[model samples]
Target chain A: MSTCKTAIRISAKAPRITILPLIQRRHESSARRHKKLLHLPQAPSYAPDRSAPSLIFNPPSSSPNVYHTPLKFLPKDDKRRTLYQTALNLSTHAALRRSTSAIATSGTPLTTSSHLPPRPSATLPPPVRAPYEKKYHLADKEIEEIRRLRLSDPDKWTRARLAEKFGCSQFFVGLVVKSHEKAERVEAEHERMRTRWGARRRAAREDRSRRKEMWGRDE
Target chain B: MKRIRIARCGTQLLAPPSPRRPLCPHVVRFQKTITLHNYRIQSRLQSTAAAREASNFEIESIVEEVESSANDFPSSTWTSPRHTPLELLPSPHPSAALKSAKLAALRSRLSLPPRFPLQTLARTLIHPSADPDPTFNNGSLSILGANLLGYYTTEHILCNYPRLPMSVVFAAQWAYIGPKALATVASEWGIEAAAEPGGEIDPGLLQFKRLRSGDDLPTLLKGKQAPWKWNVTMTNKILKSDEFGSTASRPDAQQLQGMPVPIEEAAQSFVRALIGSLYLHLGRPLTKRFFRDHFLSRHLDMDKLFDFRTPTRDLSRLCAREGFEAPVARLISETGRHSNHPVFIVGVYSGKDKLGEGAGSSLNEARIRAAAAALKAWYLYKPLEVTVPSSTEGEVDTSKWKPNMVDCGEVIV
Candidate 1:
């Protein structure tokens, strides 16, 4: 019975060898190379170099930023005024050295360093409108005339119309002239509107003002 | 003296009893010895009674005895010291200072000099509410201490950050030496309060009539004006308000006598009284050191105190006032423009120089933050090597003093 079973197993395996040629086989070395390419190198440790200078590279957490101080804020006699400039120079020099070394070894110069960025030569987008300029053309007389126009017929000479007439911004017109009656009327109207507000709306509005007040306190 | 007079009156009334007891000479000697023993005990009781009574009649008799014996002795021979019991006194006696281990521990804990008498230290613990008498209570010392604290804190803040706005200045002052801050400082010093203030209580413990639980706040502490009616201007606050710039004035310590006060009030009073007594005992230099170590050493971020509503407008107004180029916000960098969480970094620049930078989730928020940062930078500028006005208060030499820069005041918008 054992011999019969052995013969049957051998017959089952004999037909499986003939199916090998039907499948294409790749080179084992190519497969090995593909596996090697996918394998990643271990990440570099963040520990500081033992031979590096003791100058602080990374400050403790929650520490204030060193660059928060603006140059204008520094007094003329302050040592920190020159310290920042020296640091900037040193950082730039270090970046140059790193870039040069990289270029020598890899044939490609590094574009940026960790600390110093390349100086911004490109013009920044204008903060205000391109055509906007402060015009000193509006004299005291013009201001007086604007005030008179607003005082005589506030409804007719609204801020927009006055600004258009003087070729100035409505902000300037508002600054030059104010209507107390209009303010009082608006305040009364707002009060009337507030009286109609339900409890939830009133609470929300009150909370908003309270929040606004807390802003100055940085609450 | 009153007890002695009563004893003499009883002896006169019961003289027949003394005559009946003299039957035998030997027995008489025994009776004499017994009478002497009884007299010794009576004298002891009399001394205690005299100490307890502390009456004007006893004082007059002593003075009369001294007057009658003036020719017999040049120096004071009569020394009948009277000590009132602790329970009878309103506050603890100065002599009790030596017996208090807590007071001694507190002294050593504070590192005070041996010369800083514990008696004064003990007096400082007695709040006006506990002891109504000005002589025993901490009321006067607290007033003095409050003034000194205000002066020190004001000079420090004003000199360190010269350009701080009035509101910020008031807030910073409040943050440093306000009632709440002082109370916190007191508690941090490991001060323990007495269950109930009394003369018999330990001198080391803070003595104040504590407000009962669930009791309504004192009327003095409650808001005096309606919330909507309150419209105190900054100028008015500076001129008329307390150091914290509150519209309501601080209540007098004496006015709270026998009334229950909140722990904060009592703790603040104790701290102030401590400062005042330290000033008197140790002088200005050491007191200044104490202030620096205890109060100024605490961390307070000046930047966090600012709450800017219209930073962009304020910055422009500041620029116009200072004769600088108008501040303009420019985008420095941005990422994830089309993503759910976009970040934009904006810098506020006056001309070629950047004043401040801030990063926020959106362009408008970043711009506003940048403006606020710029305003803060302008306000929080600290001059190096600042000499507070108080430092040179008593110095005769004026050569080393450099006058601090007084800014044209904060930007009004």
Candidate 2:
């Protein structure tokens, strides 16, 4: 038989239905994962696997996109992948609290939940319809704070605490934190640059001596 | 202008009606059909870009005719062959304006590197009859069971290449294809290949790069994460190259055994195999380590290296440790060439220290020379009567043997 037809018509006569609904579906899934962030640390008790002979820790699952922040630091090794996921989970919790508190501190206790007490209008920040973005956007310094709490914390911040502090759903906070080799490399590079800067004063003196000697010889 | 620019920036939000056509020409011809197609396309694109808030399709694709028409003219939204306007559904979203902004920002932040290209071995397999490698009996592995010298040798060869599993190139060649196929190959044998490469090597691998540094546990172990514990703390501690010249030495010294062939002369095939596996792993040919005339050359005959076990002895225990079986441990023990073990070279047990022993590199080399000394011991201590006490008078007194040149043919197997 001859080869099958090469030209496959991708879109029907109508394209919008195919496009917009798909995006909406994806955002809804992301929102599901984001909403779950609030429940992570105290998330329903450890349900044992009936089939397993022993207690095995199940990897906490999230929307696959949750790893976007954490996996960047790890190599391809599985242990690294797990470590990265753990770190991301930690940060996601912290980031949620951070984001919420910042929004709250600005006097907008924008708790979408009806269960939360009504805020005093006098204490509230101006209700600017910042389109859910400017209010949620992470600042560079705040990003640094979240990163430090996740990476350098002695007790290793738990998922719940992170969520509570960052004002995010605990699950979203968990996603915001992660560890990686690339991060290590970045840290190393930063140190190297700092060391170079530290040596500049000594080099300047040595250069001055050489220049003076050259001037004397010319005279 | 602002609306057009927003649409332009979020190009992926709509698939541009082929660059061949004006914006949404199909809308006029079949308006309802076009609208249906746009919604379907968005879901497909969303699946791939689920992880990212905004992907290339969301940012760069052109607006589909149906969605655009609906958004632009909400009054004329539906057509079920009867021109009744569909109720304006809540623009199904966090709103298009928010999406457009997120897509634009995420697009700027995105960057990904290109992956490694396929190499010669891959290219050869894809195009049959590409090289001298005979396809005949390409799969048959006869009689060779556990502890077979040939099997170990082939494994040791591939161990030199860091990432390649032996089965990847040999057993179910599909291993190089991907993780799923590789997992299948491993499961068939009831062996789950480690998620990460064990990253160890053959004992003879003097040139391997240590990914980390280790000041302790001896440089031979090279701080490799043990397949057992996989402790990350023990990273890349390598031995200095200069020290390699002093420590690596040959096993035997005295006389060549068997056909009196040079050890190096016999080891050509082994060396070829070694180089071939290295070529496969490193993506580069083994040149510097192969052609060296240094101490390594002076000690072990790369030629006599007919088995993998020979190199396995000099190399560290960690080197032989592949994913599952530690094959080198068995091969090293079976050779029976160490002085501690006895072999076929018959000689009296007179223990005179041999010459090569003094110049040998490791104790393995010293022991090898001691065995050769055993060969000479048999001749030197041959006890006999002083005057040839032959019971039969007719027997010629030729019983007393005379001296001949002391020679033990090449010792390689």
Candidate 3:
């Protein structure tokens, strides 16, 4: 990489010297292609002659210039053949389009296991616990007492403070001490805090949008 | 090297101070009398005081000569035919269009029939900024053409993809025949503007007064810009705005007469004029064919126009509206969860039927992708058999006409 950088830096000084670095970059791309091929453990090694100017090789695992991959390597009775073919078919023009990411599906559960490689269950590592889990459970009366204290001094007794006192997660404290009036009041107080700097922030945002619309270049 | 003395540039309005020894003797010369074509025009200007006032821009000595000439022999000009100088005319004479090879070539290039007169084509090239006269300018034709273009584009979008959201439909319309798009189409058609508009220029070239560089744009072009609080409703946009659903008020074409306009505006006006003239001469059938060949043939990806804020919620709402089961996004497959690079494939299902599938680097991303895919599928539904309403016009047989499925518009949030 340092040699490539040096070659590029020196090549700018003399126009004729750019050819060597150009060849070197092509060699690097070819080397990357080889490394990518190496990742497929099931495929045979495709090491080509280094002295040659170019190497032309296509792996047997996949076909070139076509939509569908070659299924010749799969055994006759393999269950994954149909699934793989279906996936390939679905990716083509006729099938459903690949949708973009959006806000609504931001917190969806991840549990799909169909196409995943089957690994030994014993070999897999144990799952980790959530960061905000309570160390000990609270009794019904204790929960009631915490809720009462939270509602009595809504501004003073914040979710964090109540959670710390009860030795429970802030999420659990939130559920226990929920009151519409208290929530609205706290929200109003938060808004009041932000209102002091709101004008400046809004001006900055408007200026940014205006600049972007006019010139298209970022300042 | 010898130092060169460059003369300072000055306009007629601000004549430079008289030099001690004039480099050019004409700079300090006495005003010459006008004997050329001034006699005929001077007598004609006598009737209208406003025209006489406008002629004040002429040399002071020439105006004196015209006044003397008008009093001396007003009968001689009235007896003979009037002769208006070519340079005095705002635009080329209609007869000049017949002689221009460029005009003929342009006509054949567009494959317009010989019946479509070159005079009308020449008239189309003359923007109101170039020639303010209603007969010579393209203002009225452009208005007609703009309405026709809007009608055709709106119907095509609505009848084809009836389920498209209002915003997406507006975007699609803009993409198809907006000012920028029309300008692009005009340039592609080999339309070239003259250096400046005058009677001496070829009729084939587009004629419009060029906007001066760095000048503050006219009020009409600087549309009414409202702040975010204005709350420009979609209903108001549809009812009040231009075909593109823009909230800003467009400049009136008539008001832009004799004023300098941007090249894009001139080019767009030319395209609209061409369509308007074609509709008048060739009738509706040929105009439809021309529209299909030119505008409709351009490639615009409808699916890429969507920018969903919440795809999952929109999809669920769509399913609910259509009386389908509520959509459920289930992870179909995943790999490398603990590693830096994880792949998750998700499928959105409404009951047993899988609506759409997608894959991403994270579970949430995959789910979002799946939901968006399902929503797109619902929006992009096209019936196998379709017939546009325009196709049925003037047809003797209506047997082949099938009623197009009009899906209720996209789910609004």
lDDT of 1 by residue, B1-413 (tens): 23234334323321212223434445444444445223322233343343432222221233334244333332222222233355655566555778999999999998998878787888888998887867568898899999999999999999988889999899999999999999999898889999887668788899888899999978876536536677778888889878888877888888888888889898999999999988876778999999999999999999988888888899889878777788778878779999999987777877766787777767877777777778888888887778888888778898889888787789888
State the weakest 10-residue window (summed lDDT) of model 1 chain B. B10-19
Give the best candidate by TM-score.
1
Show model 1 residue runs off by greater than 4 Å. Answer: A1-67, A75-79, A93-98, A101-131, A136-166, A176-219, B1-85, B220-231, B393-400
- Which stretches of candidate 2 lie above 4 Å from their native place? A1-219, B1-19, B22-75, B78-111, B114-169, B172-413
| Residue range A36-84, candidate 2, lDDT tens digits | 5333432112432245765545568321221122222122442655764
The two-chain DockQ for each candidate, comma-separated, is 0.21, 0.00, 0.03
Residues B1-413, candidate 2: write the lDDT tens digits: 23333333223222333322335554444434444435433433343223333223332344463445434443233223222111221111112223333223322322101111111111111101111112111011111111122233333223322222222223221122122332332233232111111112111111111233332323322222336554322112113211011122222211111112211222221223222322233322222232222112323221121222232222222212312222111111112445665332111111121111111222333333322222212112211122212122244655553322222321222
Residue B16 lDDT in candidate 1 = 19
* Per-model TM against the reference: 0.72, 0.14, 0.60
TM-score of 3: 0.60
TM-score of 2: 0.14
Q: TM-score of the B chain in model 2?
A: 0.17
* Candidate models: Cα lDDT each: 0.73, 0.29, 0.68
Error of 1 at B374 (Å): 0.8
lDDT by residue for model 3 (A1-219), tens:
112223344355666733444453343355655666444432111333245766545546311111121232223443456876676666543322432233322222233222222322313221111223226679999998998888888778888988888888788888887867878887999789767767889799778656433221101
Native-contact fraction for each model? 0.30, 0.00, 0.00
